[model samples]
Target: MANTMTSYTDAQIMKALLTKDFSGIGREFVDDVITSVKVGAFTGAQNLDKVSLPSVKEVHYCAFQNAAITTLDLPWGELEAIGFSAFAGASGLPQNPVFSKLTALSNGAFAGTSDKKNTDLRTISLPLWTGSSFSEGSGFSNSTGGIFAYCTALTSVSAPELQSLPTQMLYYCQALEEVVFPKVSTVNSGAFNYCSNLKKIDLGGAITRLGSAFMANASKVTALILRGVTTVPTLGSTTFNSTAVKSGNCYVYVPKALEATFKVASNWSTYASQIRAIEDYPDICGS
Candidate 1:
């Protein structure tokens, strides 16, 4: 049942949202009033994207189980956190919404979507998350056993602000072919579990930890560049498990001066068969 009240204060607005009574409520009501939207507020809304709340600077744990949202226009600068499964099961969302100013995202924030054919979105771009950190089971997880298991059409990602990735961060994005994570440091288990199409991964020199990070995507990865890195991280028991690339088939490029050092390092010695000097591959490491 929807509330038909014509007038609503912020408290009433919060109540109306929590109770699923959005009768006379519209964008005008929100833009004219509501300044912050927190968790448990938009737990189950039907059509909120129709309204653009320029006045709202913070949106957290909103838009849960909603089936009819096509566009969301929020003031990202004023935004704080997008809690767990905030927009899960919103299968009809066509493209990735822009969140240029968001700082934090909890697990599975936008994970499970509807299984309707043609409903699978193509891309998700987060251009501004300079100070953000993604917790476990977050980013994009298909909690329902591959129902929304992967963003098959997702080919590009630009998350330079990411400092670390929790478990299964981009676990099953099979068609993902491009990624740009310039400052990532720690990678937990299953971080890029089955990204079969991403052929190259550059963990830059700042990487110091790898927690079973890449167990299954090793075959498709033709190049593994860890430039400027001098030390090897604590490798998991299955750090390079079940990789199809035979010895000499794939290349692991380390800093030129550290090539020999890596070959003799613990855990790294497992991939010594595929190891090479970074300078050997000018395409990846400029001469």
Candidate 2:
């Protein structure tokens, strides 16, 4: 007697694949033993390495948790919202080689240590990210939850359109030397906690807030340029204590409009001489 399980309908197979229903008959159905998988009835699997997802138009939770996906290339799309731990522990995908296409990433979309072993990623470009996570001092700060935390080979991040940085986004990228922030509006706490090699931080005129410990423990950052910042919060004590900001060895350039504010602030007064109201100067990182 031979095994005689009935074949599933195409609609059923498709539903299983889209939902990741890897159980019982569903598993055997997608094993490709008898039929090929399809996306929304489309049958060609060749050149399908990149799959486009429907724009999540509403607030949803855990959209893709523990998924087996290897890469994602979202095009001119917007994620309305994401639940906590949306992309947590996706251990199968490799480091993204081209991240410029991603316009937005929801909170905790790529959180946790699931993919820490695959650290070959070197470059990233997100042009439209505006969330606080994009701010160098927010929750996405280098010492806290940055995706590339401890990724020593990362050299540069060119996000000219990013408006904010979550805390600790690039906290300990030891090899990072240069960064270009175009439309940044805020830098939150612990943004670049211990990036020892970061030498230059150029902020456009949109920034308004500077959080606590924004550049703490970065000994190599010698020069800083602030053009559009108007409200300079108290530069927290012990923050930058280990870096050039400690012994008044680093040069801090501020717009003339902010010269008075820096001079008045008690925390900034100590370094007032090092802080100059200048328009331009040589590259901070010796590039």
- lDDT winner: 1
What C-alpha lDDT do the candidate models reach, one value each? Answer: 0.58, 0.53
lDDT of 1 by residue, 195-220 (tens): 77877777663667676645366457
Residue range 130-195, candidate 2, lDDT tens digits: 552322234332221454455555677767777777666776777787676857777877677677
TM-score of each: 0.75, 0.63
After TM-score superposition, the amount by which residue 196's alpha carbon in candidate 1 deviates from its true location, in angstroms, is 2.6
Worst 10-residue lDDT window, candidate 1: 140-149
Residue 141 lDDT (model 2)? 23
